[model samples]
Target: METVRVNLGSRSYDIALTHGATANLGAFVRAALPKTSSVLVVGDSNSWPHAESIQATLTRAGLRAGSAVVPAGEASKCLERLAGLYDALYELAADRSTAVVAVGGGVIGDLAGFAAATYNRGLPLVMVPTTLLSMVDSSVGGKTGINHPKGKNLIGSFHQPAGVWIDLAFLNTLPAREFISGLAEVVKYGVILDAAFFAYLESNSHAVRTRDPGALLRVVTRSCRLKADVVEQDEYERTGLRAVLNYGHTFAHAFETCGGYGTLLHGEAVSIGMECAAQLARKLGLIGDEFVSRQTKLLDALGLPTAPPTRWPADDLIAVMRRDKKAVGGQMRFILPTRLGEVKLFDDVPEPLVRTVLESAVSR
Candidate 1:
């Protein structure tokens, strides 16, 4: 097992990465919340088996544990499902001393984390991420929320988890498309922060595609460590440091919103979003065509989409972008890449230029 610590003074926690770590979740939960006697295991339908096993383990450990399974997918990240979770927790008689164990991908983590953050003021959150996207991004940040009708992640909070347990074994059952979707975020980390990591991914593409254990360990560990360093510097997005983490998210979120939330997976939108950002950067002369080509090649090799789905309208997508959380004073803000391993927050980009890029991405 490998451990990465998020040093946040009193709020600090550890991300434990290992094969079959979920089997030992009972002990891990006990160590993280020694005073807690009850746990609310929240999982999606696809991940309920793991949640069931976890509940059984906790029961054997003499802890009062109950579980509620929600439908899987992006549509579930809404106010209705969130309310359902609150009701379920109340039925479970969960109190402030209760800990929430989130099992599954980003959707489950965000929904359960939000439930834990708001229930009776707050409750401890333990993340058991089953997808690559959650393991690398959402599970560690403490950013939790349900989506509103208007935008993606429009309603959310920064409530950090007490512990994040990542088990490689979960990926064995992960769908191939979902697995490919996750590589987008992994590529994001390399694009915005580590050129060497990006090169490493390029060289080891075959190993990563095959889910070789050693490559996965390195990819996940490095991704978490990079994100933790950023979170440590700007836990709540006060400084612009954390903004870099949204390298392609501004465009991605808009794509998701325009797609009616279920049209494409989050990471699929992100893969295309990153491509758009790179193209926009090229148009602005922030980077050369070579940079865009390299990114496109890598994404293509990873089986990720680099172009917006033709069905989505570019103008409607731009409207959605205006409501992005990063928008300030009704003006847009984007974390644009200046080059691989580097990016900067660019605000108030002209609407015409934005439309031009969106049109190209959509029409291509």
Candidate 2:
């Protein structure tokens, strides 16, 4: 097992990554909180098999596990669904000492973690991320919440989990499209921080698509390391250094909101978003044209969409982008790459230029 520590002062925790970590989840969660008794195991229906195994393990270990399974989709992240989960937790009588284990992808993690954060004035959370995207990103950051129709992650809190358990084996059951979609976030790690990691992906993109264990471990660990390092520096996202993690998310949220949530998987949107951001960078002369081609080619090779299909009205996307929490007042702030390995937030990016890039990305 490869363990990376997310140093967040009092909120510090470790992320354990391995192939078969799910089998030993009971032990890990118990070790993290010996007194944890009643746990609300929140998962999506697609993840029920693993959730069942986890519930059974907890039961065998003398912990009472109550489950709340939601339908699998972005629609599950709603106020009504979240309220229902709170009602379930209340019925189960979950206390502050009780642990909440989120056993699915990013949607479940965000919803369940928010429940843990707000229920009974906050309880301990143990996230067992089953998706590649969640394992490498969402499951650790403590940024938990459901989406409002207005925007993604607009209603969230910074509630750090007790620990995160990453089992790469769960990814084997993921659909090929979903797995490929996940590579978008993994690629974001390389784009924002590590030039060498980007090169490695260039070389090993095939192995990743094939689900090679060695390649999986390397990419997951490297992505986690980059996230952990940034979280350590700015846990609350107040310093703006951590905003680099949103390299492609600015465009991604617009895609999700404008097209409706389920129309594009978050990672799929991000794949296109990254390419769009790269194009904008090139347009601004911040990066060379070669960088844009390299990004698009890798995304194309991975069977992920590199651009939005329809010429979505740039004005509509701009409207959604303006509503993003990262935006300052009405001005748009973006994490734009200056080079392959480094990205910086640019607040002065003209709205006309942004609209032009959005128009270009969709038209192409």
Candidate 3:
């Protein structure tokens, strides 16, 4: 097992990554949670079957578990769905002391975290992340929310979890596309901070995709450690260190928004967005053609999309980017890669250059 700590002072927590850790979840929660008598297990419909095992584990350990099942997909992460979950929680007779366990992907984590944050003011939120993207990113940082029609994760709050339980066995059931999407986030960890890790991915992409236990464990542990290190230093994203995690998200949000929700998965948008960012970096002379080609090639090899849909107009892409949370005073803030693993924030990025990059990216 690999453990990473997010030191947020009062809200600090630990993220544990292991191949077959689910079996020990009850014991871990009992040791970590102040009161484990009751927990609301929130998961997507697709995750309910596996969640049954988790429910049993919790029950056998003296924890009474109530479950709320939401439809699986991005569309469910909305106010309406949240409202439904709120009703379910009410029917379940949950209280402030009830611990909420989110046992699916990013969508479940975001919704359940938000519910726990708002339920009777607040509850102890426990995360049992079953997806790669959730394990490395969404499950660690306190950032939780559902998407609005206007933008992704627009309506949310920063509610950190009490603990995060990651079990690699769930990856065995993840579809190929979902698995590759998770790798996009894994790559993001490298692109933003660890160049050596990026090189490792470049060399071992195939093995990682094939679900080699050793390779997946190494990648997940490293990614979680890096993210935890940054979040501990800047828990509320007060410092810009945490913002670097959005290296490719500016373009990614635009891609997903324009493409329509469900048309492109978050990871898929990110994969293409990273390519767009790389192109922008090269156009700005921040990096060279060789670097862009290298990143794009590795992304392609992973079976992830490396280009935005050509159907979107450059103007639309630019328009959506302007609405991103990172935008300032009507100017867009971009997370650009200055080198292979070093990303920087650039508020001075000109519109023309941005437009040019978007045109080239979507056209490709």
Local accuracy by lDDT, each model: 0.90, 0.89, 0.86
lDDT for residue 116 in candidate 1, whole number 0-100:
92
Off by over 4 Å in 2: none
Instruction: Give the root-mean-square deviation of each candidate in angstroms.
Output: 1.1, 1.0, 1.2
- Models ranked on TM-score: 2, 1, 3
- Candidate 2 per-residue lDDT, tens place, 1-364, comes to 8899888878888899878756677888888888898798889998999999999988887889999999999898888989988999988988766899999999999999998999887999999898888988898788999998888888989999999998899999999888888899988988999989999999988998899999999999999999989888888899998899999889999999999988998999999899888888888899998898888888887788988867778889999888889998988888999998899999899788888889788668
Please estimate how well model 3 matches the true structure, expressed as its whole-model Cα lDDT. 0.86
Write out the backbone clash pairs for model 1: none
| lDDT of each residue in 288-343, candidate 3, tens digit only | 99988888888887788997655688788889888888787778888898887798
Worst 10 residues of 3 by lDDT: 355-364
Candidate with the larger lDDT of 1 and 3 = 1
Model 2 lDDT vs. the true structure?
A: 0.89
TM-score of 1: 0.98
Steric clash pairs (candidate 3): none
Candidate 2 residue pairs in clash (backbone atoms < 3 Å): none
Q: Which candidate leads the pack in lDDT?
A: 1
